[model samples]
Target chain A: MSAAGAGPGSREGHREPRRAVDGALRADTADTADTADTADTADNPGLAARVTTRRGGFTLDVAVEVAHGEVVAVLGPNGSGKSTLLGTLAGLFDPESATVTLADRVLTDTDAGITVPVHRRRVGLLSQQALLFPHLTAHENVAFGPRCAGQGRRAAGAVADRWLAEMGVAELADRRPSELSGGQAQRVAIARALAVEPDLLLLDEPFAALDVDAAPAVRAVLRRVVRDSVVGGQTVLLVTHDVLDAVVLADRLVVLADGEVVEQGPTAEVLARPRSGFAARIAGLDLVTGTACAGGLHTLDGTLVSGAASEPLDHGDPAVAVFAPRSVAVHRERPAGSPRNVVPVRLAAMEPQGEVVRLRAGASGRGPAWGEGLAADVTPAAVAELGVEPGDELWFAVKATEVAVHPSGR
Target chain B: MTRAAPSSPRTRSSRTGSTGHTLPWPVWVPAVVGFGLIAVPVAGLVLRADWPNFLTLITSDAALDALRLSLQTGLTSTALCLLFGTPLALVLARSDLPGLPVWRSIVLLPLVLPPVVGGLTLLFLLGRTGPVGQLLDAWFGVTVPFSTVAVVIAQTFVAMPFLVVSLEGALRTAGDRYEAVAATLGASPMTALRRVTIPVVLPGLVSGAVLAFARALGEFGATVAFAGSLQGTTRTLPLLIYLDSQDDLDSAVALSLLLVVVAVVVIVATRTRDASGVR
Candidate 1:
């Protein structure tokens, strides 16, 4: 029942905070700087939390910090504890041992036995579904938080109207939840969450239930509100599956995998030079982990991947070579004259990616050691001409200049 | 095999209806017969009523007093059921308390227990020589047996299970998704219950109360056993009807029709509210 034993396996794979590449933002350095700068000051940085909780068979052990008026997007695949992290922060779910400090307020400190109840936490949450109160009109739904906070009826209605207008749903104020469309309902939900002026906002995939046409508009509204609404300097923790949301709305990106933080940095920097396999996959780049060699890296499977060094590395230091799928050329035979890196692979699957067919290739032969291979984006005409099917022995060639070698934290 | 032409919209519609029909033809015969089994008795009750003297028969002082007492006790019992049974239903449906199925079964015992047994159960606890009755008699010299309060207590004993079962089903179906949302919006537990939980299940509450009222109005065996049929004091409409039926058949039938009409009105009112789909 102790916190140390809560997640025995988490610490074993917990690597030291990965060093950022050249021209990249390092979270560790920034955290230290913020700490040093705010040591004696009364100014509080928004939210700093260390959460360790286990639900069912899954264990989530993570530490996260967000500055005031900052939006940190948590990106992860399903079952990666993204929602659990938000729940822990919002006080909807209890954590075994957690220190969640928001806006200089000790919301949760299990050591101190000061776990604030959800209603008193002042952490507004906008879940995937709108989840508006069915019996209330849009205006009343928005007014709910204010009323709960003991506002007068007239004052609450005024606040509701203001928020409704802010979310562009003022005209739908009197309409009940059932009368509003999906987009309108979501807009009302956003207004309801913001009406509280919470110290921290927890958004769990708010745009996920929205249609493509609605998603962009909602995302834009969220971007505007999260950035422009600095009245309370609200710190927002947004959990999302879409990379575009991170790109558009977030100031930083925290990538989670298997209930642990894999990588985190400034959004653009992490997307550009992702260290974890999960981040690389979401960024649509192929990452090959290996040992630093003369030019690039020697993969575990003995494939010498040559690429330009994006970060400094010592001899035999652990490193990774990253390349885009479009940089790879598929050949029937090993016919790479210019490209230095060539590997013999077996076609695993072919998926159409808009204008091109993404041919996924893995290690050839019946070896149990199927190295995470490369994805090659070839034109459909080229695929038809090559007549390639799954299990076909193919040669994947990548130009050395296309790949970027960097020192990996692992 | 000969085939009919796929001709008119009318024929096509009929065939489509046949295609959609999942049950066999024989099922309809038994279903209709089952419907008649319930409907025919009510038809007979209407047909057997002495219409010419209906006003005179139902306007007697005993009849009026019984009717008034039935309404008063039924309403009070229904209110009591709502006040007590709502929290019980909420606990049974929402709380994570262990051994809840046992508690739920115990609460629903009145539904399955015969009315006479239920009356005896209440009597043993509250009768003059019983423990609670003895305490009351010793402390306040207040006798509860064979009183109007006894009638209400017996009615609530047998009728509250309906309210509990109905409201519990509604609470379970409505779920806590809205309640969770309300909590996130800064609503405390009480506020969420008053605003979100109660409002969401208002229709169910109304229907459950109506059902409890109807059952209380029709209570006879429990009332007769626990609170003897004293015309103006302990006797309700059903007890009066039972008493009058022994000798005055005409008044008994008229009272019976009045009870039926009241039950129908209660049921119809609830139906109209449900049909309106008012939150």
Candidate 2:
């Protein structure tokens, strides 16, 4: 444990010291106040990064911050520059322009011509693959970081054992990555990354490869480690597509779409009131962007969507109408009903969700479609009763009270 | 002892007397001819070998010396290949150096060049009258041509390309993701290569070394052209066999059989090791 503290980046040691108090998952700390270069840790207290890069047709420009001891999850769809952001932060991907400051260190500043090497950045990355050295056992894999930092063989082994115990994989210390299951290997990989005692831990879809049965256990392990990291004042940045990952692990959410930050807020707030199409889709909410009018909101196509304002908004201000799919009812024809908001739509797609079938309607399918992203949820029995298939001309009826309008946060 | 029949009797019955491996009828003709083109020469040598005197002919002093020198020089050249070629392979596969394609083409020259041309190139570089040879002569009164060291150099010149090409392909296939992961784990580039890259590609290195050793052992034109056939001094098994054929054909045939045995053993051993080493 003491040897683990002897990292090339002593700053990393200060961030996460090896602890062994509990049987295998000890919660202990080393008191080392040699914070000479870390004077700004209290002022900025976390990570501030602005990265921009262009490769071929794709361009990524993003700025994000994480408070000290906070976990910020970067949520994005595939090819949305999540990997680029993490790569630039970890110093693996060179950026055309970037200013990255973690705690007290300026890791990268293109204007200053300063780019910290990947190994010296003290930014540990746990990618989708565990990527443990195939030749090394779990114990040796964990010891590698300490050994690279100039610790003696015995000292590195001691550090490895302590970290392995902390990760609750002490019993698997002798097994190679090939012998370990996905969950076990990921656990060992976590220990290997933490053995370096990095200042920032970046998790890139750490549970994407695990099975449903194995993911929850790994998520629990990560939750415990993230909590420990918070106690040690270490910052964590998670990149994931799963809303559950953001809900369970992150303090803040930064949603990216098309290589830009489309929305970001507190995790709970963003989940409840997502502004971006990607965010709303993951949150299972239907969002239509328009301008607030006297009656409700007017879409760019001049279709009126009547709804109650969830927040105060001025007339002509950009607003969004949000409603759950379950709140919308599908009808074969315009019926004289209490629902005031009814629009003609063509069924575009259908997908089964646990107990209900979700039917989506788009503008391309049929007659005078009002909106493209309208959806409704109905039970299988209701679907059979309707006898609908894709391309069917349908009317989507929603009560004005069902839609909630709020400022678009544009 | 009674045994249970295979559960899928219909499938087993259909597979009777057939191993489930078949190629089109046209392929067997050229396949057999191509294999015979390689196998017939060794069959001829084995058939023509003086069986009663084969042991004594190969165990002769000059034959034994040539065998020893060939083994020694082949091993030394293989060692040299591994030492110098591994880094060259890494650079060719991983480095962003300008004109790397041209450099890789130059490194692969030995693979396609005639062994005589390779020998002549080495001679021009390291011969006594050559640039580097003149320096060695002036500085240390050393003569490289017609020496055992010259045999090793010629063999290494012709054999190293195999090692480098094999290893570079392995490096390319393995990719750098693991090294990047190691770097993030605080491993320096050199450390990552030593601990991660090298271990991951150990099978490639072993197979490459074996290929180089076999090529060095069989090197004929290069060793003869550069290092003259001086018995017990520079002549290797190939040179000895050539010289033996000028007089005693039995000795030459026996030695050829020895090389065939060595080459077969090396190739078979490498194939099995490769099969097991690769996950």
Candidate 3:
């Protein structure tokens, strides 16, 4: 909303003022523009949402806040209440507590004793499957939303055409969904959702089913359309398993595990420092638990290693050291290196992992106290140059800065 | 795509014998037996049909009245069934309503119930002295029993469930995902039903409607029991056939052939409509 931080790729850490300015400016501009057209109605801001469900000994409780022009990604592992959150938000799953609000409008507030019917809520939802009406052509499908909004046939058709054109799918307007490619159908679904001009937009893994190549293109188009919504403020919520997608489009990442928010923060920060093992896995990191001391960090398995001290260390305080696989430098012998933390370890195994070869190494004298063997991901070229092999004694250098140490509670 | 090369007579015979190993007797044998069983009724209808007197039999006043009434009531019942049943099917198949299993079972009850039972039930509920019937008679002073309306009601009571059950299955299989997509586009539930749900399940709905209509036209036990076999009133073609069979078998056979022909024509027309609708 504020223009202060509009500069591209400015990495000023903790730019709260700039972010606040931008957010305020954007919100103000949208507010003024919407009021000019829609008469500044109190019901305009829509509602905020929350859902809690318990079934078969599993509890799903997700609380989500959606702002206009912003896309909130609900990220979690499978069975982590992502879809449940989306469904609850969409008014499909009735929650015991309810408490879903939009703008100032109460969608489902148990305390207030209100539960709006789904059809009357004016919220639009897109699922993994586009679910376009198979019997209708693209144009007809687009027109369907406006028609449902009580527009006349001709008016709805015109609106549908405008949306179809906006989606860049006008050329295929006469084609049915069965005749469409996966990406095209999703685009049409988006266009249909837009045509209705819903107060809230709910997407449940809209791109999860798409091929990798198709997902990015569809996501780009979706982001563009969502950015240009006519509603003074449109709330967008996405539930997805793809972490990269959350990082790419979401303003905030809400990580759910076992139906609870394990971690949540700005997209970049959350990706950088995931708070839980599930969050770390989602962010593509391996989490290991250990302890720290003045000499070095000691593993529960009794393996001691020289590493950066996260805190002013006491004799034996519990801690965790997280290092990227790429950060661990493997050497055939004790090689001279600029890196400070070096440990003698035996290569446990080697396996090809995508573009790199991942090496698993264990310290000789008792393994890391509580953690498993440390893993190092290196390129095939690095593996070949180092002559790294199983059973070989090697010196691995882990830079102090690369090692992210945190106090361990467990 | 290429055709198999022609084999020598002995080789073909040997190939045929060997093919038996791959194909089981239960599959082809039952198919053959079913076809033969179906052919028997057709062969009887054709062989026994007096073509020269067919026109006379059909043109008879009683037969003509019965045929007209059958077509009229059957069509009316089918139309009512579609109007009410399709949406009911959509609700049963799509909504997450509590007690859905119970509602589904209720909708399908008529399908398995004997038509005579359905007619009797309708008679009890809609008869002149019945609860609803008493109110209708008190307000409108209209008696429905032994009338064309009674025949239509009897047929609808027996036949509507067939359309609803088939269409419900189709709706369930097709899913409500498309309806959700439509809703996101600002379509109300009703609009979504009319524009998306109806068209998506058209093939199933049409086929089911036709089947119901055919069933309605041939309904006899129910019509006779509830609406009564009154001449030029509730005497549908099936009722007439049943009545005529008591006096003349040839006339009954002629009426049966006519009904069969009509069913075949309706089926062909429906298939044609379905094929074009898909495209």
What does candidate 2's lDDT look like per residue over B177-233, in tens digits?
Answer: 889999998889989999889988887788889989999999988888889899988
Cα lDDT tens digits, model 1, B54-78, are: 9999999999999999999999999
Better of 1 and 3 by DockQ: 3
Better of 2 and 3 by lDDT: 2
Cα-based lDDT at residue A1, candidate 1: 4
> How would you encode candidate 1's per-residue C-alpha lDDT over A1-410 as one tens digit per residue?
00010122222111122222222434432432322223212254467788888866778888887666667788999989888889889887888988888878899999999988888888899988888887788999999999999999999999999988888889999887766666788899999999998888898998887778888678767666777643544578889887766766676678888888888766645765466757867867666767888888888777688887754557887666777889989899888379888777899888787898988776686432323356788999999999999999888888899988765533
Instruction: Write candidate 2's Cα lDDT for A1-410 as tens digits.
Output: 01112101222332332232113321212221221223333454577788888955688888876656667788888898999999999999999999888878999999999999999999999987788887788999999999999999999999999888877889999886766877888888888988888889899999998778877677767766766542375578999997667766776678888887777655645665455657867768666767888768887678789998754568997666777889989999886869978888888788787799988886754433345667789999999999999998888888999987755532
TM-score for each model? 0.76, 0.73, 0.71
Q: Could you tell me which residue pairs clash in candidate 2?
A: none
DockQ of 3: 0.25
Instruction: Score candidate 3 by TM-score against the native.
Output: 0.71
Query: Given candidate 3, what's the lDDT at residue B254?
Result: 94
Candidate 1 wrongly placed segments (more than 4 Å): A1-42, A229-233, A285-376, A379-410, B1-30, B277-279
Poorest 10 consecutive residues of model 2 chain B by lDDT?
B1-10
* Candidate 3 per-residue C-alpha lDDT over A38-136 given as tens digits, one digit per residue, 9 for 90 to 100: 222222443355567884457876655544555667788788877777766677666677577665667788778887767777788988877777667
